[model samples]
Target: MHDTTHHALQRQRRQVIWGLTLIAFGVAYLLQRDDGDAVVRLWQYWPWVLVAFGVNNMLPPTDGRRFVDGLSQVLFGAWFWITIEGWWGLNFGNSWPLLIIVGGLGMVLQPLAHRYFPRHQEERS
Candidate 1:
């Protein structure tokens, strides 16, 4: 019974995330329709989608793997945005190594997270 309730909650969370995502896209579409230049501006902000997804993944009930995945997404998204925007004189050519570093961080952190924050056996099942 508990498992069923948990599953239902998870499903509801996922539905909420997807619904919000759809609404966001719809609003963007409307903006684009109203102003053609909005499409160009929106294109540059594409990496924010990854950040949103990452945040969604990090929501409650997340485990080690999910948390690591979310963290990587957020880091990568922010890094990509920074590189594209050339903030602080950083660009893809010079800042690409950060991607590798982020990957390594995720790899290193996942096991440690799991070790320290093990999930309940019931949750696992």
Candidate 2:
């Protein structure tokens, strides 16, 4: 039952991943200018974004309680993006949406993980 939902969600994400094509195109334009500020900023925060993305993909199948608890306590992806930007006092501009997108993806993953892989146990009466 749950496996079907999980597979469907993964398929949906695979489709939405196309949106990132625009990111590459935009970056190419920025780098073409070769502005030092643009280049340095790109190098600085890009890794964090990548890390968030990786974590999102690898979120494990676990009890929904653990998943919800962790996500609520720690902000990854877009949440981290906003925190880093705010700490540096940079007005979050275009990248602001990434935070929600990334963070929300984790939320999405949590349910999917739980739906697909709920904690296994003996049936309780």
Candidate 3:
């Protein structure tokens, strides 16, 4: 049944993400800096966890709700990444307002997006 295939696909995607994360960790361990500062450096990558979750939500059989949720996740992850990296001097203190604006924008735009690309009934199940 379609349900079975969907579950299988989800499982496979999860396994892939897990496998890649472990591999990245293993490589980081092998290439770690002297005095074990590598682990400290790796801690900065926590935002990637959100990115992974966002990517998972973007897999397939997209629905309006999931599409919006996935977009939010991706945007939040990117925002966090930028904040953590201090890119262009963006940080929580300075950029928090952008979050509210972007979130509101997404909410306002969702209905229009859904209208333009109506969800198919088969995709819902």
Candidate 4:
């Protein structure tokens, strides 16, 4: 019974979040429709999508997989901002090493984190 209640609560939370996100997007769409230049310039903020993904992965009940995915998203978002968006005029060739570093860190830390801070096994039951 407790698990059932927990599952129901999780479902409710997800529904609420989805509904709010849709409403927010609707508002943003309406607000941007009147400004042609703003709409066009919006493409430059594409890295935000990666950031959003990263945030989603880091949301509550985080685990090893989510941690790795979140880390990748954050790293990708930063790389996109620096190289694609040219935030600091960084070159892709020079920035490739950053990707390597992030990936290596994720690989090294994930096991240790999972070992030390394992998620509760109750959800699995």
Candidate 5:
């Protein structure tokens, strides 16, 4: 029963992710048809994809490792996006160290997260 529930939840998560992806694609397509420049501008937001994937990984029932991985991805994506936008004078040249920082933080946090909020074990059917 636990296995079944886990599988069902996984399936539902996949469906939701795919559905949102399709909708995004459809919107992009419509925007492309209406104004090519709009689509080009939209392409600049690609970093959000990484953030979205990170959020997905951190979804409910995920293990500490996955959560940490997701958190790193989210941080990296946001940092990259900010760099690209030149926010606060940040650029690839100066901001590259942040990637390493985020990785180190994730490594440290993953063990602590696991120790405190252990993963849920699904029983075998």
Candidate 6:
């Protein structure tokens, strides 16, 4: 079970890395995003960055490191959301298959990311 959990966690990390890479590839479109830009349109569905933030923060803290990492993730997500909405003028579209694929992937990884986080251990007396 533990091995399974660890494997799942690793898989989640890979998913996150790949998903973000796909999003990053949209940067050119993101930079020039308008109604006609497919890449930017694709990135428009990233509100789940906020959802990931919420999930990442709800983990047990082992020490200051965990807290800092959580804080950073939350901040990064918030910044990403705000910048995309405010600056990028984000909007959703009918890119059903791709949107579903990416969103579902990111969502699936959230729980596994939470699982891999350091856990608070009992104090040795």
Candidate whose TM-score is highest: 5
Off by over 4 Å in 5: 1-8, 121-125
lDDT by residue (1-125, candidate 6, tens digit) is 25456446645754785677566656756666665666546666575565464444444332233444455555456555655566555333322244455455556655555455434322211
lDDT of 5: 0.79
Residue clash pairs of candidate 6: none
Candidate 6 positional error at 110, Å? 23
Error of 3 at 82 (Å): 0.9
Per-residue C-alpha lDDT of model 5 across residues 1-125, encoded as one tens digit per residue: 35567567767876787688779977887868878778777767878878887888788767677779889989988997998899999999999998889989998998787775453432331
Model 2: C-alpha RMSD to truth? 9.5
Q: Count the backbone clashes (under 3 Å) in each candidate.
A: 0, 1, 0, 0, 0, 0
| Residue 48 in model 1: lDDT | 81
What shift in Å separates residue 107 of candidate 5 from its native position after superposition? 0.7
lDDT of 3: 0.75
How much lDDT does each candidate structure score? 0.80, 0.51, 0.75, 0.70, 0.79, 0.51
State the lDDT at 23 in candidate 1: 84
What does the lDDT read for residue 80 in candidate 6? 58
Candidate 1: the clashing residue pairs are none
Q: What's the alpha carbon RMSD for model 6?
A: 12.5
2 against 4, candidate with superior TM-score: 4
Weakest ten-residue segment in model 5 by summed lDDT? 116-125
Best by lDDT: 1
> TM-score for every candidate vs. truth?
0.81, 0.36, 0.76, 0.68, 0.82, 0.34
- The per-residue C-alpha lDDT of model 2 at residue 11 equals 54
Which ranges in model 1 have alpha carbons more than 4 Å from their true place?
A: 1-11, 120-125
Which parts of model 2 have CA positions greater than 4 angstroms off?
A: 18-25, 28-32, 47-74, 78-125
lDDT of candidate 2 over 54-117, digit per residue (tens): 4434455324544554454345533455555676554456456655665677667775656754
Worst 10-residue lDDT window, candidate 6: 116-125
**Which stretches of candidate 4 lie above 4 Å from their native place?**
1-26, 120-125
